[model samples]
Target: MLYFIWQKRGDKPLNKSQKAEDQSISYQDWQQFFQEIESKLLRWRRDLHQYPEVGWTEYRTTYWLGQELVQLGYKLSVGKEALVSKARMGVPEPEVLKQAENRALAEGVPLEWIKRMEGGHTGLVACWETGRPGPHFAFRFDIDALPIDEGKEDGHFPYQEGFRSRYRGQMHACAHDGHAAIGLGLASWIACFNKVLNGSYTLLFQPAEEGSRGAKAMVEKGWLDDVDYFVAGHIGLQPLNIGDVVATTSGFLATSKLNVFFHGKAAHAGVEPEQGKNALLAAATAALHLQAIPRHSQGATRLNVGKLVAGKGRNIIPDQAFMEIETRGETTELNRYMVREAKRIIQAAAHMYDVQLEIVEVGEGLGGESDKEWVDIVQKACRNAIYVQHVLPHLQAGGSEDATYMMRRVQERGGKATYMVFGTPLPAGHHHPCFDFDERVLMVAVETLGRCILQLT
Candidate 1:
């Protein structure tokens, strides 16, 4: 069945003449269109950066995108919810793959993937089709902000320049603003010359990536059923020169976040100390023991207690306590081991202190290993594009992403997946108050993705 689907998607080998012609046309058209859309792309990026929204609440952002799509002459369909669009690929059927290939050959640029999804109110998919036939390719972009307040004082770019977020306490601290804008820029440019693409393609604008929820929901809802190849990128604070692309070769750490609570009797410190069980003491003891959880000798492991709250009054023995904790490892088996060991230590501490204990799982993310075939394609594409430097292959990474859910899903269904890191010079590291990224790197990312799509399709 899988082989049949591959053949039907036009995964057959191309002759030398056909390949050369396709590459020539794709290169010429991309250069021309990128030049035409540069200004609009920059403006769109700035607009999104100025008014950031958090997670699933990208109301204004989604609305603005919808308006843009309508202006571009694409057929827009409302998603299951508001602030979302399920935009269809352009005319030409027999599946989107063939149409995209035909379009790429004819127009010099390829239009393989563009489909809008109904990912809550903030999700959208834009699909492009060439008249020829082939497999479906997908590129995912996450568009959501963090819960931090935007820079408010004078001298900050957003505040001083008068482009700060209208929504207080919501900002694009994680650089997702750039991601959304780049995706939109790609969509707009691709739509203009849909005649050269060889196969079907879908561009997914996902929401709630901060909470690690959106990608899984999209998959469960069948947003990737027809996708054969999937790709996504993220902006980071590494010191690599602008436009340098980094691809991870091995799996990253799998993480599980937990909240542990302990309940006990409250009493006066001096008068009723003997009658009260100290939940605060138990929680503290558990936290200390948690730190002692040995880092696995076989693979990397980590345990962190980020937050702890115990008592309100100095004179009273606190009755309740809670702590936010995380356990991580290089693989699922190791992560599970660490979690189980931590749980044992917490339970033991609670018993010793005579306090009731509860553990709640807050968020979880699995690690991902790069697909060698897809990585090679990305490397070649980056090498071919200007302003991009291909660094050495990554051996392992500690970064965690919800996109791993999408990658795993695709693998389960017999598809190829690759996640790359697009380097941008930043003054501060990720998730920091001073985090900032150079915008020029985005142009390289856009060019790299465009080239990769052309080659793969």
Candidate 2:
């Protein structure tokens, strides 16, 4: 059902029929949708790629997407309107968050949207309902980019063409840009065909997904309150051909992101060194001990100190230092154990070095158990679609994803939910500078999801 057209590079602006590795696909279930939204999908992808934003700080991205979805005839809720304040976890300090909002305002985000999204609370929920009433179905799409410089390599397509990221140190290295495009494409389908569609539909364009930050807040805000069935997905996991789709994904590692700070009195290295309490030493010691945390005998476990910075100058006993770390485990209980041990190690290091220490959780996500019956539903839906050539029964996820937070919530309240992967060929692995995917996957995702929603409702 899927085939690749190997071609030598002789490009005059590649199009639907071309292949360099030609990462293009042909769709079956929705032909008019192909013609109607195909060009729009590519346009939306590039426009978002050009103006990338990181989690929580996705002010402009949220505003733009909100406007578009509302224009497509769906009712929209954003910022504090859709998010609960006290429920927001792992938030940056007020001033730091304000700067990001200010930057978005100066860059042209609508003031109406900006006002609601103040303090970096950026995400939205769009609802399309048939007044006659039925079960409410939900689809989630994450909308945040990574903090990496867009590759300026001349051969890179984004740079070669006109739509590369305009932001200096932010780029859509992950496929959120594509995910947003797919969500919007799916919205168009839902809006245009609502009369024929059953049940009510809700689409979540979640913010700050990079650190497992956004979904919990939405869950607490009751975003999935009435959801009867829920589905969420990512673009690519491991490598696969253009038309492969993982109908059920499990084993998203439960994880926590933490920021550690150590404070002490600074002093000159040669003068009164004895008066100084070295924070740098305390932080460095804690980092090493954190990594040496014993592996769980029960299930898989992981710990990493992704960043450590201290010391202002060579002549000073550093009085301040910082560390950013994350812990992961195959299950939620195991992750909690690692976090507990980590805190103990940090407290001991602070006492030994006579420095003040603070450990703050900036983000967190719990592991999930994919309901087998829900998997069967998604599998049957994909198998029935012409767009999917392979319907993977069970492909466990290798990384942590916050979508499970919402999934668990829906399931907790007598709802059925599952996370799937819209598998597609990639030019490079996720989070790499050259990451890109076959655009045809967007079309297939719409059709497959549409089929599933239709079947469920």
Candidate 3:
């Protein structure tokens, strides 16, 4: 029936004329419907990019998201409670516990910790029920910006035109602005065709994906309890020529972020040089040692010291130094090994330099493997929606994502998960100061996601 419907629509961008007798109205109707939503999707993308928000601190973003969902008639539950029950664990801090007790007295949240949580790192889930029973699907959209400055050039829009971010030193260099917009666009499009949906579908507008923190709270709260299939998309620079889509099959490196700090006594360099214990020397030695960590022959592994801060002035010996570093590998075991080796290097360096060393783990993400079933569905949907010479099977990605957490959890429950990489024409690479994407890919992403939801649900 689906094949016949697809043929009748005459909307196959990849394949032309099938027998006219085989054309189906249902497929044609959806094609036309999707085309109609393109303009709205574009607007949403631009609006989101114009006012990007950072992770967990998405107050205005969440408020706007909730308003949009409510306007679409979704019964809104604000904060974590609207999605799931609290985890069995209590507050991690004594100060938080006291605050929770006091906040519980107020009307907004039941506890102070919950209230604090409500203020920052807010998340929202919007559900649309079709009154028909089948598989339940969940789609996640990450809405966070990076802590980089925006690029201001003639080709760029507002930034070039002098409409930069009001909050300086913060910009959406990662293209999450595009991700959030696509999510809202998908929700609006799906809401219009709610009656035709096969089953229950939830739009999970997630926050703080940059730090891998937001999804844990939402999952523990039971937001993912009923979801049978999950999907998420990330916009990236087009490795290929313009107008091409890039999809990865496998190879995301599980990553761990650590902050290494070295402490020593400070002294005047010219007057009392012997009295100073230079922490900067220790930090620099460790940074070089980190690069020397051997790569595993079994899979890919890497270590990078991305940021470093040390010292006050040239005349004063540094009392403290800090390095922001990351380690990654193709598998969890390798990542663990890299982290262990990293710690040993830092400790050894500090010991040699007579400085106190501390290593703090900030974030960790597991590598993800693509589900064949979900990949097939995405490929089919994309092929049907646009012209393509070939559908790539699996593309390997080396970056880390919190979605890997969701993928692991779902796979443990025997559910399928897939992450898609949608191509955009960008002149610069991701995380670069000058990064930007061709907005046209926004439309392609919407159509791809919309069709996949229709076919899967």
Model number with the top lDDT: 2
User: What digit string (tens of lDDT, one per residue) describes model 1 on residues 428-452?
Assistant: 6666545666666566677767777
lDDT of 2 by residue, 1-457 (tens): 1122112123122233321121122243254555677778878888999989988888889988987997998999888877777666667778877888888889898677778888878889998888856789888999999888888776666777778899888899888998999999889988766766778888999998899998988888887988998888888878776567777788889999999999988998997899999999999999888878899999999999999999999999999999999999999999999999999999999999999998889889999866767667766666545556677777878699988899899999989888877777666788888777766677777876776766676
**How do the candidates rank by lDDT, highest first?**
2, 3, 1
TM-score: which is higher, 1 or 3?
3
Q: Provide the lDDT at 318 for model 3.
A: 97
Which stretches of candidate 3 lie above 4 Å from their native place? 1-28, 82-119, 157-164, 211-213, 240-248, 386-390
Cα shift from native, residue 17, model 1 (Å) = 25
In terms of TM-score, the best-performing candidate is 2
TM-score of 1: 0.78
RMSD of each: 12.6, 4.8, 7.2
What ranges in model 1 sit over 4 Å off? 1-28, 69-122, 127-132, 150-160, 165-168, 247-249, 382-395
